[model samples]
Target chain A: MPKVTFPRMGESYRAFRMLMNDLGNEVIIPPRPNKKTLDFGVRYSPEFACLPLKILTGTYVETCMSGAELIITSGGSGPCRAGLYGQLHKKILNSIGFPVDIIVFEAPKSHPIDFLRKVKRVNSSRLSYLAIWECVKRGWEKLKYLDDLEKTTHALRPRELKKGSTTKVYREVLEWIDGAYAMKEIHEAGKEALNTLKLVPHDTRRAVLRVGIVGEIYVLLEPASNLEIEETLGNLGVEVHRSMFLTGWTRDNTVKETSGILSVKEAAMPYIPLCIGGHGRESVGHTILYARDGFDGVIQMAPFTCIPEIVARTILTRVSREHNIPVLTFFLDEQTGKAGMSTRLEAFVDLIRRKKNAPVSDNRIIVG
Target chain B: MKAYMGIDVGSVSTNIAVLSHAGEILADLYIRTRGRPLEAILAGLTEIAGLLPAEVEICGCGSTGSGRYLAGVMIGADVIKNEITAHAVAASIYVPDVQTVLEIGGQDSKIIIMRNGIVTDFAMNTVCAAGTGSFLDQQASRLNIPIADFGELALSSSAPVRIAGRCTVFAESDMIHKQQMGHKLTDIINGLCEALVRNYLNNVGKGKEILSPVVFQGGVAANAGIKAAFERALGLPIIIPRHFGVMGAIGAAQLAREEVEKTGQTLFKGFKIAGLPYRTGSFECGGCPNNCEIAEIYEEDRVIGRWGARCQRWDVL
Candidate 1:
């Protein structure tokens, strides 16, 4: 069996590992991205590449160095620079003497046979197409479970009586979910995780800031990419409402658009009116939805020089104004300073809190 | 006799202000940090402590600015806040209906938009300090003119020349080009001020609704040229508060007073903290590949607090 590795993106690595293992390929998990990984990426990759690409490049390098024979990463066709990242990573890795075989997973909609063939390359067990589909379905189920766990954690974090307790439970639940292979075991683990989370001694009466996070998917999901923004906000007593999740993204891209749910296109039609690639349209649409839902504030985070998000950033100004909501945009890159980020977040929280507590014309408090 | 103390330890300056229980500024000291925050803070504390009457007692203490955490730990602050909120609070206190706050500090600049005395939106310079005080300081020295006189020279200008304000390097070259083209010194200086104000408005002030009753407060608010430029650009009279330079410190003190009153006690360690021999040391933590530089504060060789680690492993306090 060929040794294969995939770049880590939040909890998606777990699902990818499961899929690879079931396909009978030896799976090598890349190190969780850290300062050294970022340093490697920044040193080797082009300075202008988006942060996710650079971080992925660093992950691939480290994985290859650790004796992995094959690297797998997602591919896309869009105006967003993300489409070219896989190729860029491959070139950058090969030039740096890694020379590992790279497989890019494109959307089945665009290249069904190519995608299946690429998947078959790592299907060392020579599993039938039906068996491979089953493995993918299980992986998708794991992603759904992970996202559910994350959402519950985000909501409970602000109201927990004991500080850092929610995070502790979240980590323990994540470990159990990762270790479970049987669908029944995974389902039980998820149910137990929710029950445990519900028992985490929370004060429902506590007045917490409800902030919506909208941005490119990679930066929004990856803690290292966004500098642990969700945790930082939660620790500051704000309930984070993320507008993007991996499972939702996979569903939107791969299957029929679910009706009745707030469609990104329709919600964004008023402001953007077009898909500009990446999550740019979604970012705008979500900000509007969050504003209409009376969120205290919205934070738009994206990699530096990301064209799609740059468009979204501009449109967000109007969304913020028309909706009377405050929006803070962060362009994350290697040069981003930690202290600066914290300061901005603290100030943003104070801004929304004051707005929430301020008396309106009727002398009623606006608690959002 | 009861007072609150606020300390703002910034990259360029360390400001200490003492406010009586009634929010009256009793004593304020502004000292250049000069790349040594602790020393500057201690020096400011010593000066302010001496300036206050012997009967006065610090009932609460707060810290704000980039070095706020360090200052807060050192002073046993009841409240620690970011500079944006501190500046907004101070501006609202001075002008109850303040709608906008333009703060240009040493290394950064901020534009805060307020509605009904509450901060609605705010932005700071992102990854660039192009039109901030530091750039002005460098330009002043390059022109062989003292920083204090740079504003006056701008005020005396008859015809302001146009200069690019996109980046510091480009701005400097543009100034030199106009200077070599025989533009008067005052004209170039005024032009530079206008350029910086334009840059600030287009960058940090981007998309912000800058309304009337706008207040400009920060270390750079001392410059009349920038104020005049802001007034000209926005077509609204800019109000420079009496304690504009120490507004952040004043706000911190005000917050401290509120916190102490709510908690019914103060965490202030007293003015004697200035005399304490505190030592600071930092080391790269080997626990992870992040190699976060863990900063530790010591009192008489005993570690009092540790910070700067990304993870909780080295976060003992």
Candidate 2:
């Protein structure tokens, strides 16, 4: 069986690892994207390539160096540069003389049977179809459980009486979830984690500011890329509501092709009438939804030179104006400084706080 | 009399403002940083200390700007704020009913939308130096005119020539071409100001509602040419507040006062810090593959601060 490896994206990697392991393959999870990973990626990647692509390249190189024979990454088919990432990454890796087989699970929009055949090839385990289905189900359950725990952590982090309590608990909970092998054990661990979170002293009286974070999935999920924006906001007494979750994204893309009502595309209609590829439409839609949901503010973060995001940004300004909801946009690149980001975040949080406390009769026209 | 102090150490300039308990500006100093923030900060502090009455005691202190962390550590600031908050706070204090604040500083520019003394929304120029005071300074030097006279020269021009302001490099070439075509220097200067304002509106201030009672400040606020250009661009009276150049420092001081009021104590090290021996050094941490450049600040021989490490292993605070 070929040893498989994949880049990390939040807790989704754990599920991927479990699935790959069950399929009779040894899984080597690449180290979390860090300074070295970025350095490796930036050195070889095209200078104008977006941050995610560079980081992905770095992860692949690192995995290849670590003797991972097979690399599995998702594929996109759209006007966005993401669609070309698979081919580009394969070419870049080949040019660097890295020995690895790359498999991209592109959505079965055109060649349905080819996608099924590719999936069957990856699943080399000679188990019954029922057993394979059960394994997949268990893997999904773990992913869902991890997502739920993360949601709880997000809600409780700002309200915790002692700073870092929620984070400490969250770390312990993640370990508990990761350690559980069986479905029953996973359920127990999740329940135990939720109970542990409840024990953290919370300040119920404090009015926590709510802010929604929407942007590229890679940056949003990876802490190192976005500088742990959610954690930063949480530490600043803010309850952050993220627009993208791994499970939610999986469901949106695979399970439900048509997200009819309360959809991001529908919400983004007035501003961006068409899907301009990538998550541009979703970014605009989520901001509007957040505003309508009475969030104090929304932060849109994207990689520098990302085409879809750049297009979304121009329209976001109009959305911000028409909706009368404040939106702060950050374009992250290798040159982006932590201190600069910190300053902007601090100022943004302060602005939101001031706006929240202002007298209701300020006479400005209100909009949803 | 007790005084609160605020220091803003920016890329091009360092500003210090001392304020009394009644929110009155007691002493303010603006000095060119010239790549030496420590010296500029010390000079501004010493000048401010000398200008103020001996009876006035320094109570609380705050720091803001790109070099805020360094300044905060050096001054023992009670409140350390970003330039955005500092500028917005100062503008609100100066003009209580200010709905919009267009602040163009030495290295950056920002559009702050305020409603009823509170900042509702704000946008800063992204990694661009075209819409800043530095660009104007460069243009002024190129035109063989002192930066002090650039604004007045711009205001004097009746027929301002058009210059491309989308990029600094393009704008410079456009200015040269206009100059070669026998355009008046004042007209070119005015044109440059207009170009900057247009760039600001199209980029930083894009989709931002520019309401009236607009307060313009920052180092560039001293330029009448840019102020007039902004007023013309917005078709609204741009109010340049008193002490516009030192507003960031003033805002920091005001925030420091607020901090002191809440805590009933301050972390201020006092004005004596101006004479203290301060030094900064950086080294690459080899603990991991990250190779983070850890910067350390020394007061005399004791290391008072350390930062820039991705992992908290090297962080002092």
Candidate 3:
């Protein structure tokens, strides 16, 4: 019966909460997304008007309506919109009459001390350590399952018979994982899902190029934000491997603490670290990761006014050429045209597949 | 007779310059980045290649700007530095005591605060276009003022009006409102300059110390209107160096000279850099549990650079 709220992604939190929580305090569901939520968002938000914000604004309202005194949240920074989301949420919630205490779980601004402060907020009375430990274990397990499943989906994307069938199967399996009772059950279920989907009988000899989509999680995740670049690429017979995962999301903290210059995650390296600064640094790091992971190409996805990604995109092209990986960028705004986007994706994939012998990045565009 | 080349690849423009030991521009080319810095850099280098001596004295190359790291590897730059350091080096040679440097480029803006000719603090608005040249370009187009006339018109404004300044949306809306209020077009346009400068001071230039002998460079410094607006905001005259937009390229060339004189050996691969066939790839290191993703850049088949490796460990290989 735990009341939990998270920023909306694909579907209603009401249907998803049964998957997010196990049994606990009563769940306080947020109202469905509407103009009222958008209004609250703009009124309270810092005029950026990104959609994930509307969901966040509503989450707070519903949490207050349900009278939840405690809230759980995390912090992020970016070469994308999510970097300042935590600060925006705090400000918006404060303005719209929701004064519920919010615990930002991911501020490692001071390393372990920040985390320790947040842990104290998770009901530090009796079962504190146990509760925190359990939460970490579960979250880690969830991320591993998610990354592994998604990675498997990426590998088998070229072989899936139906449109987004790998995604569809992965989604079903993930929903099952949320309710899964045991680790063995999760393992078996993952294997079963993979086995069932790999049997879709796709032609393995088509040789579709692999495209790595990297950028703000929202632009990369939401089809509309990215102008359906993934779908466009998939339709073009190019397999899309999205680089941002919950694992990368979690790993970004180490990048953030080092402020993008130092790889805090790696202690023994002797290279002169280039901190792109902020979450944009993570974008460069991840894009390069995609190149190294055998993607024939990379796409630096972003919105109209994003700062960090702009900085990161410059570096990504060099990385692509240096690595012989082709990169195409898709920057979206309200004016972004689907036809234009599809044309670009189709042409880019064709270029990569056709001219694997040519050179890295013979094409580039800036959506002004 | 040692010569060095430098490239400044930005999202908006690609600048290339080759300098002699005596600090003369032997060959320089400026090309609109047109959103493709790589293409621009390559094209510019190709144009300059025919202009240089076939067997020029060897020297190092350096690159710095928004596209520095990429330009570095592409051109085989011997040194790569941030715009603040590179710009400061070039500006210090020109102004010697530029305490403050305000640079407005196509998509990014930076404020470099220096003390005694050394950079102390710097802030940049790479995200906000309201304080950059793009803002001026949009305002110019929306107001129907030829971008070339935008500066002169601002100079004639009887009373500069108020613009929202915080965001381009509000600023555009405010401009429309001012237009409807019977304000002269020049006044409204001049007001935009004020609004942009005001917003820059309040946002990117906030809380940092601003000293005199200030120099403004970058692509936007060519606009006399912006220069005037900055002087009005600071109540002090500012200096615009002779070569403004390509200061980054100039800085790179200057840095290459300094490095070559210091190390007495240059890493510049040569003019054939443009013709070299390069290759690169990415991989995940299972060396440890981190499973760090790594990217390696190669020339032909030899590794030239490694990035995205969380630990420099892979780079050591």
Candidate 4:
């Protein structure tokens, strides 16, 4: 079987590795990105490309070094620049002497034969239809479990009795989910993960500030790209509710959108009315939804120069005004240092906390 | 008399303010940081201590500005807050119904919108220092005029010329071209002020509602020309607080008072720390591939606090 690799996007890569391994390919899981990866990415990629593309470029570079023969990444067809990143990455890699084939899983409806051929290349062992179905089902189930654990972790982080205990359990659960191979093992791991989370000592009566995170999917998922914003907020005693999860994203694009169930596009129609691509419409829609849900504040994070999010960010100011909720936008790039980001976040949390407590007609002085 | 102390360690200046329980500014001192925050903070503290009445006691202390963490750790701050919150607090407290706050400091500028004494929204300059006080300071020195005189000189302009206010690089070049074209010094100075106001409104103040009762407070609020330009641009009177330059410090003092009163105790290390030996240094931890640079604060050879690590391995507070 040929060695295949894909860029890391948070914990979703483990499920992707499982899928590729089940399809009979030697899936080389790329290392979790760090400063070195970002440095390599910034050095090789074009200066103006958004952060995700640069990170992915760095991922591909490290993946090639790990003896991966081919790269597989999802492709987009929209106004967002991500659609063209696969081709750009390929050319850049080829020029840098890593002559590897890149297979992009574009919308299957657009080019069914091309998609099938690319799939066959990875499924070199000629897995039967039943086997492929089973492999896909297992991958899907694992992704769902991972997303559920993450959602629970977000809710639990603010209320945990011991600081960082919930995160420790969450990390252990992630490893358990990653280690599980068979369907039965996966089921057992998921149940055990939930039970383990339940065991985390938490205060149900403690009032915590709630913040919703909405923006581009890549930055939202990849902690390395976003400076671990969710963790930072959670540690600051905030209940973070993010708009996108992998399973929800998968369902939205594949099944939900077509079936007219849970459509962010429709929710966004009153504001944006059209898909500007790269989760921008979803960002606006999610901000409105979060506002309607009475979240104290909404944070929109995007890589610098991401056209779609920029559009969403501009419109979000109006959404913030009308919804009477504070919105803070962060344009992430290589130069975005941790100290500065934390300062802004701390101030934002302070703002929302004060706003929430503003109804008290006296002794208006409040600080934490 | 009991007082709360606040120290704002900014990029350019270290401001120390002592406020009474009633929020009246009792004593304040502003010292140039000159790239050394620790010495500046210590000097400011000593000077502020001397300026206050000998009987006045420091009941609480807070720190703000870019170097807030360093200041907070050193002084044992009761409340360490960001510049945005500090400024908004000071503005709302001083003006009572301040709907907007325009604060331009050494390296950054921020626009804060408030409603009913609560900060509704705020924005700081993102990755740009073009329209801030430092640029104006640089241009003033380059023009052979003291920064203190730049504003008055601008106010004397009769026929102010127009300059592009998009980027600092372009603005500097445009200013030179205007100077070489034999434009009057005051005209060019006023023009520069207008350009900076335009750039600030476009960039940092973008998409923000600049309602009335705007309070302009920061180091740059000392500039009459910028104030005039802002008044022209927004068509509203800009209120510069009596302690405009040290409003961040004042806000910090207010926050400290609030926190100290609620908790019934202060974390202040006391005014005696001004004479103590303090040192700060950073080292790259090679524990992981990230190689995070860990910053350490030391008092007489013992590490008091450590931070900046992605992992909390060295985060001993």
Best by TM-score, which number? Answer: 1
lDDT of 2 by residue, A1-368 (tens): 88899878877787888888998888888777777788899988999999999999999888888788888878775688988887788889889998677888777655567677777767878766688778888889889988888888788889998777887778777888788777898789878977887788898788999999988888998877887788878889999998888878776665445563247788998888887888888899999999899999999999999888899888888888787688899998876367778888998999888877877845667898
- Tens digits of per-residue lDDT, candidate 4, A119-208, equal 787887799878987998889989989889888988888899988888788878899889888899999998898889878999989899
Is candidate 1 or 4 superior in TM-score? 1
User: What DockQ does each candidate score versus the true complex, computed on alpha carbons?
Assistant: 0.69, 0.53, 0.02, 0.61
Please name the candidate that would achieve the greatest DockQ relative to the true structure: 1
- Over the stretch A244-286, how does candidate 3's per-residue lDDT look in tens digits? 6555555555435333324321321222144443445656665
Candidate 2: C-alpha lDDT:
0.86
Comparing candidate 2 with candidate 3, which one achieves the higher lDDT? Answer: 2
Give per-residue CA lDDT, model 2, range B97-212, as digits (tens): 89999998888899998876777888888768899999888877777789999889999998959999999999999999989999998898899999999999999998878899
lDDT tens string, model 3, B13-49? Answer: 8888787777777877778888766567668888878
Interface RMSD of each: 1.5, 2.3, 19.6, 1.4
The C-alpha TM-scores of every prediction are 0.96, 0.93, 0.50, 0.95
Off by over 4 Å in 1: A260-262, A361-368, B286-291
**Ranked candidates (DockQ, high to low):** 1, 4, 2, 3
Ranking by TM-score: 1, 4, 2, 3
lDDT of 4 by residue, B121-221 (tens): 89998877889999999999998899999889889999979988888999999999999999998999999999999999988888898999999989999
- Order the numbered candidates by lDDT, best leading: 4, 1, 2, 3
Q: lDDT score, residue A128, model 1? A: 96
What is the C-alpha lDDT profile of model 1 across B1-317, one tens digit per residue? 99998999999999988999787899998899999887888788889889999999889999999989888888889999999989988898889999999999999899998878778889999867887999999998888898998888899999869999999989999999999999999999999999999999988998888999999999899999999999999999999999998999999999999899899999988888889898899988888665777888886677767877765676554
Question: Over 4 Å off in model 2, which ranges?
Answer: A108-111, A126-129, A258-262, A362-368, B141-145, B156-159, B176-187, B283-293, B301-303, B309-317
